[model samples]
Each structure stands twice: as C-alpha cells, then as structure tokens.
Target: MQYLFRLSAIYVRHRRLALAFFCLLQAQAAVAGDLFHTDNADLYSRAFAVVPAAISGDTQLKFGDTPPNLRLRNSLIIGTGAALVAVYGSNNWWQSGFGGGFDTTNEGWFGSGTKFGGADKLGHAYINYAGVRLLTPLFESAGNNRDDSLSLALWSSLGIYTAVEVVDGFSHNWKFSPQDAIANVSGAVLGVALETHPGLDAMFDFRIDYRRSPRSPKFDPFGDYSAQKYLFVVKADGFASLRENSFLRYFEIAAGYGTGGYDTGGNHQRSTYAGLSLNLSRLLADDAYGGHMHATAFQRGTDRLFDLVQFPTIGYARRSLD
Candidate 1:
C-alpha cells in the first residue's frame, strides 16, 4: 500500500512527462498509417509544405521542439509502420464486412468528411481523439511558439490520412478517401488555430463526427441496407504550460469539449459529452550534440521511474538525472 501511494505521488509529479511521451510515441507509431503512401507524394508534399508556410510564415520546418533527425528515414519508419498496421487491421475488419469510408459534411475542418457510423462502431472517434491529444502536446512544450508544433501536427495527420487513403485506394473493399484526408488536415489546422490564434478560442476546438449511411458507396455494399444513423461529436480543447522559473521543469494541461448522438437523415440528433483535454509533457534531456530525449509520463513517480529504470536500459541515462 505504501508503495502504491508512493507510486501515485510519483506519477502525480511527472504526469505531464508521462502523458507527452506516451502520446507522442503513440502518434509517432499509430497515427502515421494514413500519411506515408506514395499514391500522391507530390501532392502530399505540397500540401504538407503549405501548412508550415501558412502556419509558421517562415520556410523552416516544424520537426517538433527537438533537434536534428534524418527527415526521410524518420518519416518512412513512422509512416510505413502506421500504414501497415492500418492495412492489416483494416483487412481484418473488412472481412467482418466493415469497410471504412468518408463522411459527407461541409462543417468539418476544411470542408471534408471523416465521420463513421453504425451503432457498434461508436468508439472509433475515441481513437482519433487519443491521437490528437497525444500529438498536440508535442507542440505545446515550446516556450511560446506553437506554429511549428501545429504545422508538424497537420503534416503528420495528413501523412497518416494519406497513407490510409493510398491503401484504400488500392483495396477492393474501400477507395482512397481524399476528402477524409482533407478533413483531417483541416481538423488539425483548426486545433492549431485554437492554440495560436486567441480569437478562435471561443468558437473552435477539437471535434469528431462519425456517420454510417446506406446510400454511401463505402457502406451500401457491405450488408445491412437501412439508412444507419450513428454519432456526431464536437470538442473544444487546448493545452497550456505553467513556468515558475527556467529551472523547475514545465507543466501543461489539455482540455476540450466532446458531444455526440444519432443523426437520422433529416436532422442530426445529438448527445452531450463534455470532458477536459489535459496532458503534460516536458523535455527529458538535451545534449551538446544537437540530440535530445523526451517523455510524457503522467505522474512524478512514473516519470522518475522512467528516468531511473527505463533511461539506463535505453542508454539515455542522462535523462534520468535530468
């Protein structure tokens, strides 16, 4: 019991680090599935380029707050791994007659469809929220500038969305949903807008809407033919940091709104789902060689444990000390 309490306290202290690390790692590993395919590399590259330029206003790339890493190799490993996972999992789901498709809505991010419906599939939006929260923190840690983080988030989101589209583009069960990709990028950009542009704070936030329709090509061929009505959720979330001095480590919080319900043709019915989006991530270590390590462990104990146990095991011993 003592150990449990100690662990709890430890986690409390390092919660931000744990959360950030885990989320970034998850985003790095899981979210890239739809971002890396070659079907439209040129278009994607251009789309990705537009985001950084638009968001940052400078030509510099937003590669996280961390320094120096090979772009191509890093993107490939993250992208390919995510794509394969999506494909493998997608195939498994398709066998059960679950072919994913795009939403048809103008209200989404940049006017794209990304909703998925059908009663049993309500939890998919949760997966997307997890990804966004995890990825968003990667941008929050910078001293003040979030444009880079926002740009990186959108770029990564687009990369994953594209990869999924590419895989679907070739598959027999689903066609590439470029519109969905647009929605994703737009949603990510919206997230950035909320963070960077204070004016949007009152009007915008993180949102997820899922729909399953019989008339839509992506779902009609499967099996059930009823005009299936599912759920639509909207959330307004943000992340901020608290600094005491240059020495005391950084603190952060991510908060948002979530709402959903069944949308039966004529009018979209709804449900109330309000929650907070909170996460705390900090830099674990910075090296003289332009290299650094970071983690998002959510509690002080876990954060410390990561520093003590995981650090030595991974040759990042210095992070533990930091």
Candidate 2:
C-alpha cells in the first residue's frame, strides 16, 4: 500500500494504455454479473446469459451468499481471459505499424521527467486493478469459493498484463517497462487483497476520475491527462460505528494525484490532493432512497459505480504539488 501511494504521487500525466482501461467504468455492469442480484438491466442481462446458459440459471444473491466450492472448468473464466488477450492484441497492438522484431524502451521516473509525465504508470496499475475486481466475481459466480476466485483473478490479471508486456517487447510503437510491470503487479495484488477482505474493500477505493480535455477537439477520456484525477479514498462508512453516525457517514478522506496542462501545449503542471471527499453514492444509497434503502438493487449499482469511478462532488484541501 505504501509503494502504491508513492507511485500514485505521480499520475498527473496519465494516458490510455489499453482499450480495456477505457472500458473499465462501463465494465462494472457487465462484469459484476449476478453478484448483487439487482433488477432491471441486471435482471435482463442475467436472463439473456441463461437462455442457453453455459453454467447456471437465475438466482438471487444475498450479501451473505457463501461459495460452495471451486470449479476449475468454467466457461466464463476461460472466455474472459481469451477476450482480454484478443481485445488487447487487436485494439492497441498487432496493428500494421505496431508490430516489429524485439526492441525495448527505457521508460522510467514517476514524475514530470518520464514520458507522458509518468502518469501512464497509473494507467498500468488501473488496468490490472480493474481487471482483478471485474474478474473475481465472475470466478466466484462460476462456483469458485472466494479464496479460489481471488487467487485466480490475481494470477489471470497478472498473466494478461505480462503477456501484453511481452508483446510490447516485440512491438514497433512501444516497449516493455519494468515500471509498468511494477505498477501492474501492485494493482493486481491490491485488487485481490481488497476483494479478499471486506473491511478493506469498504474502506478504500482506488478510483480514477476523468473529463474530456478541453484541448482535444473531441471527447477523449482515454488519453486526457489534463482532466484525469486518480483518487485513493478512505470512506467513513467502512466502520459500522461510523455508518451509524448520520453526519459523518457521507464524509471520507481522499488523496488524489493528477497532471494538468499536459493536454494543453507544453505548460505542464502536476498536483496532489488530500482532504474530505463526499461519498455521494452512500448518501443516495442509504439516507435518500425513499424508505427501501436497505441494499436495494439501485444501491448495488450506485455502490459499484462509485467504487470504480470517483463522481464529481464538492470537496476541500485540493493543492498543486508542482
């Protein structure tokens, strides 16, 4: 975690590294699957998945849902891995000029000195982190116990990224960076750890916030570092005691890092922030959801959405590090 914080101190220059990272926010709805047993889209999707189901049929999931046993031969697990490899190869790599004989690039520095302001390292981490969280539930939903699911997610996430790096080692446009590997490993481990432990999962979230860069002629959430903020948060609702504290429940501690002006010409700026962050999802999920606010399906989606993306909220203590 300390290493993660240190590396995060340098994300003002984040740009898109994978199409997967670009899809992560939307991936929540697809990947979370039957974990929450939510209604509407979730229910419809669940039914569609079972019309000729590869494994199981519709079922309600409880917060206390227990895993039965591990299932190694699962279609979802294998399909997800193959999809990642195929999408990565086709989207960012394996293109015309993107291929070449083995080569390397000495990418380094977690500051302004590195390519793309070293913020792309966070991109590496974010991809793997999102990968683990997205896949763990799929594994468990396929009948693997939590421990087995987490373990598979960790290894699969690492393997997928490592494979991408190996391809980059032979690519024409990019090179494999030890820095990226470090970030990838850090994210995979952290993802599994948080999923393995509920207390930690509730307390902290590694999330990225983004808006299209004004300099860009079109909206580009993937490559716009000027408007991207990577946030590490500790929510007050993590504690049962704090959860009962009405006023304190929606407040949280947020530490964030990002680069600005990178999207604008050469006028680069780096910033880091720490202070109170409002948990708007919690506000919507708990106190403000009419009366059926006890883990309703809407609350499930909101919680997952907030976990993956840091929605805009009023805050204080933001400061420029550069």
Candidate 3:
C-alpha cells in the first residue's frame, strides 16, 4: 500500500513535463525530415499528418482502464547500484590505475593520437548525441518531476562520457579524450535545449561523418564486409513514458527512413515504421532494469519491407539528486 501510494505521488508530480516532453518528441519526430530536405513539402506533409494520431494514441493508452504490466518477476530483479556509493567507490580505482589525471597538456581534437583531425571528433560526438536523445525516457522518469528529468539529462550524459573516458584512459590500445567528453555533454545539452526551447528547435539538424578505410579500418566494424555502402539516413526516434497505472513501461515508436542507396535503386528509398514498445525490466532482471523491446515493421519502396526487434539497454541516470 505504501509503495503504491509513493509511486502514485511521483507519477502525479511529474505528469505534465513527462507528457509534454513525450509530445514534443513525437511532434519533432513527425516533422524531423522537414529540417533536412527544406525543399520537400510533400514528405513533410505526410509526416505532419501522423502527429495527431500519435498523440491521440498516447492519450488513449494512458487513459485505458487496465494498463499493461509485463515487468520481470521479483526473483529475477535487483535494484540499481547504490547511487552515491557508485560515484565515490569507483573514484580511487579510476584515478590510480587508469592514468585518470586530467591533461592540460594535450590540446585540440585528436591531438593525443590519430588525426583525421576534426572529422574524427565530430563522428564520435554524433553517436553520443544520438545515444542521449534516444535514451531520455528511461532516465527522465515523470515520476521524478521536471527538474529531475533535466538533471538526469545533464548528469547521465556526463556519467556515460566519464565512464567511456575512464575505459579509454586506462585501456592499453586507446587514449582518453577530455575533449571528446566535453563534446558529448555539449551535444546532449544541445539536443535537450532543442527539444525544450521554441526559438532554437529548428536548429536540431546536424551531421557528423564516420569515415572508412584510410581513416581507421581497425576501429570501423563496417569495414569487415566487401560492400562499402554510404548510407544517408534521416532518422527521428524517441521513447515516451506511459502513464503510471498498472504498467512498468510503454512507448510509441515511429521512424522515417530515407537512405541514399549505392546500388541500382535509383540512389533512394523512402521508408516509414510505426509500432509500440514494451519495457522488459521485470523479465530480464539484470540487463533490463529500465530496458525495452521495440517491434516495428517498415515499408520500403513497394516490395522491400521488413520487421525488426531491437532491445535497447536502459540508459544510466545523470543525477544523484534523489
């Protein structure tokens, strides 16, 4: 009874921000392509048509009398690591062995190691930015409130960047970048700012390139295959929080895909996918504390359509502000 009440209070407190965030994401996602192909009105028209339906669906799912509950059983689950302890506990270990001391000496992008120069730094930033944008819901729970969500965004981005830096700093093969870490946090905050602020919303479109071959084949996994395809994809993806009731997690999924093909397909393909995701935290226990499974079917140029299942790990929190 006490636990249920506490959860309810959390949900009610952060309800508006959570929903606003979700709706803004859906709206942004629906029209994301417009920012790229400023010339294509028809493509954007179709995307705009889907926004109301998406918002309506979100509302109905929440208002439904019986909510979905597919969380993993108790025996399978364990709570997250003790928050404060995790930060302090791992400090000494990282500093001593990982050469974790900050370097005021190494300056500029890729200055410590390989130099594709600025492009390499940009490519790495893209992934970190995308990762943060996609994983917002898990860390920014409505149950915690708006300030919590914002805090989560800032801290989680920092934490992830720090963890990655620590690993790279200590690893025998790689050099750590305080610069890369700064870029990631900057991009994440920029992404969140784009979503929340009206005047700057349109500034969300930016591309970072990942080079092949002469750039660094060893680190590039796509180099394994004989086919080297340059894919130009316009993607808008997000996770939304379901209302707190009987369910653990629920999110609407939608994506528009336009890839410049290298083959005989006239160098283009237009695709759209829509589906629902189920959070599987209760099932997997360890791997899925706040994780989810996305099931989507995509249509590609008449006959080339397919379905996919992606289970993304829940993002770690950026804040310790309990």
Candidate 4:
C-alpha cells in the first residue's frame, strides 16, 4: 500500500512535469515566430499542414524554415529543460551519495541483477527512439537540413543517454551498463533510418506499454518491469503494392517481448507475444480534423500515447520460466 501510494505520487508529479514541458515548447515556438517576424497564423497552419504534406510528398513540406539562430535557440531550450529534469526530477539519484568517485567497471549486459528482467533496457531503447524522432522535426523547423537534423537528433539522444550512464557510474545504487549504451545507439540508429526512409517510416513504428506490477519494490516507473513490454508495430499502409486490399490497409501486426520475476533468481520469466492492432492514424488520415489530431498528438509528445492506449486486437503469448 505504501509503495502504491508513492508510485502514484511519482506518476502524478511526472505528469505535471510533462505538462509544463509541453507549455514550454509552445512558448518557445511562439517566441521563435515573433523573433523571425513570421506570421503566427502561417506558423500554426504550416505546422498542421506539414503532417499531410510529409505523408503525401508535397514539395511545400520542406523540412526547414527558421534560421540557424532559431535552431540553436530551440536546442538550447530543450537541452536545458531536459538537464533540469534529469538532475532534479530523478529523486536525487544524482545528488545522493555523490562522493563515490567515478568507477570504471562495466556492469555486465543484464544490469547487475535481473531487478526489472531487462525491461528497463527496452525502455531505454524506446525512449531514445522516440526522442530522436520527435526532435528531428523540431530541428528541421528551426532551419536545419533534414539529414543534419536527423544526425543532430541521433547524437543528442545518445548524448543524453550517455550522460545518464556517466552519472550512474558515480552513484552507489547504479553502475554503468554497456548493454544500455548499445541499446541507446541502436534506437538512435533506427530512428534516423526510419526518418530518412519514408516508406519504412510509414510502415513501421517502435512502441512501448506498461502496467503497474505488484511486485515492484519501489515506486520508480523507470525501474519497474513486472508488467512492461516493448513493441514493434508494422503499419498496414507500408505495403503499397497491396493497396487494393482495404481490409489489410487498416490493420497492423505487432511483436512484443517482456520479462517478469526479475527479483527472484530461479523464477525469472521471459515472454514473447504476437498480436494484431488497428492502424488508427492511417484509417483516419483522410479526415482533416482526425489527421491533424493524430499527427499533433503523436508527434508533440515523448510518449506514443496512441500506441500505449490502443489494446491489441488478438494476442498470443509464449512464456518461459527459468
């Protein structure tokens, strides 16, 4: 009961922080527009139009518009905001017991112990993927070339993850994991690859889902894995050759992996699942309001809310307990 209460408090706090972050982004966008003397109406319109344009391959949907200064401005704003959150919002993981001196030891691939059954590693990858994809467009809007923006997004994501590891190296509770770093790099690479390839980007998405686990020791959402799963969803529209099949065009296939019983040595469980999902965004792309809502809602947030909320149509799971 105490753990549940603390977990709820942390969740609420994080939600508030997320809301504030969104507000900050909106404010930054407005300020950038004012500095460039760009009409606000045009900015908002273009923001809304970019989604459809990007999907339709319209020439007007160039990935850049603002000047270099604006790009730097937005980058600095976001970086600083993220740094603040990491330092302060991390429940003093950075400050508590800071005198441990950096240890150069490698914490094996599986994170010392199976505390979260490697779910945290998957969380890291998904976060890096989403971070790079989300920031790439912002960089482009700030007048960066598409390729350049992708590169920036990649490095920035990796850099942030690396910074966390560096901090962990100095902490007593956590040690650096090479596996986590690899996951971060892999995710960043995937994000860049998908962003550069329109067909693949449209066809596939990386997503994550979690449910509260009674077995979690602490209230830490990042570390809890009793009921967390990472997913790869294949969009139906990716099959351009099968466009005639309307039924197939509205459906997606998903594969997911998760683990449980990390805290128990011999009771660890590994699970894999295959499922069907609805392609909501593609299904509603023709509706102006729906398209705009889908694009804005998914793009502007770090979490892929739509994917997290959508339940799988039919799922089959296989589990192995060791």
Give me the candidate number with maximum TM-score: 2
Write down the RMSD of all candidates, one decimal each.
19.5, 11.9, 21.8, 9.9
Residue 261 of candidate 3: its Cα lDDT? 26
In the range 267-295, model 4's lDDT, one tens digit per residue, is 67777778787776655564444434235
Task: List lDDT for all candidates, in order.
Answer: 0.36, 0.66, 0.34, 0.62
The weakest ten consecutive residues by lDDT in model 2 span 66-75
**Candidates 2 and 4 compared by TM-score, better number:** 2
Q: Which portions of model 2 miss their true places by more than 4 Å?
A: 1-89, 92-100, 288-298
lDDT of 2 by residue, 1-322 (tens): 9988867643311222343333322333332333333234433334434233343545544565533222223334644575655455545454533345667677875577666675677877887898788777767667666765676677667766776676677556677788888999998988987887888988999988887776866665555667777788999988889988979988988888887776568577777877577887777765667523336655765676788787777364667756
Report residue 1 deviation for candidate 2 (angstroms): 58
Q: Please state the error at residue 167 of candidate 1 in Å.
A: 1.8
Which portions of model 3 miss their true places by more than 4 Å? 1-107, 110-114, 140-142, 208-322
* Estimated TM-score for each candidate: 0.35, 0.70, 0.35, 0.68
Candidate 3 lDDT over 1-322, as tens digits, reads: 9999999766653552333233223322312222222223344345334344344654564431321121111001111211222332233222222334433324375322223323334434544554444334443332323443444444544554555454555433346676767776666766566446634431123332222333233544222111121122211222122333334333323222211222222322322223333323223322433433222121111101111112332221121111
- Model 4 error, position 205 (Å): 1.5
Q: lDDT per residue, candidate 1, 74-97, as tens digits?
A: 455445546554544344423332
Instruction: Find the 10 residues in a row with the least total lDDT in model 3.
Output: 70-79
Question: In candidate 4, which residue ranges exceed 4 Å CA deviation?
Answer: 1-68, 104-106, 110-113, 215-221, 263-267, 286-316
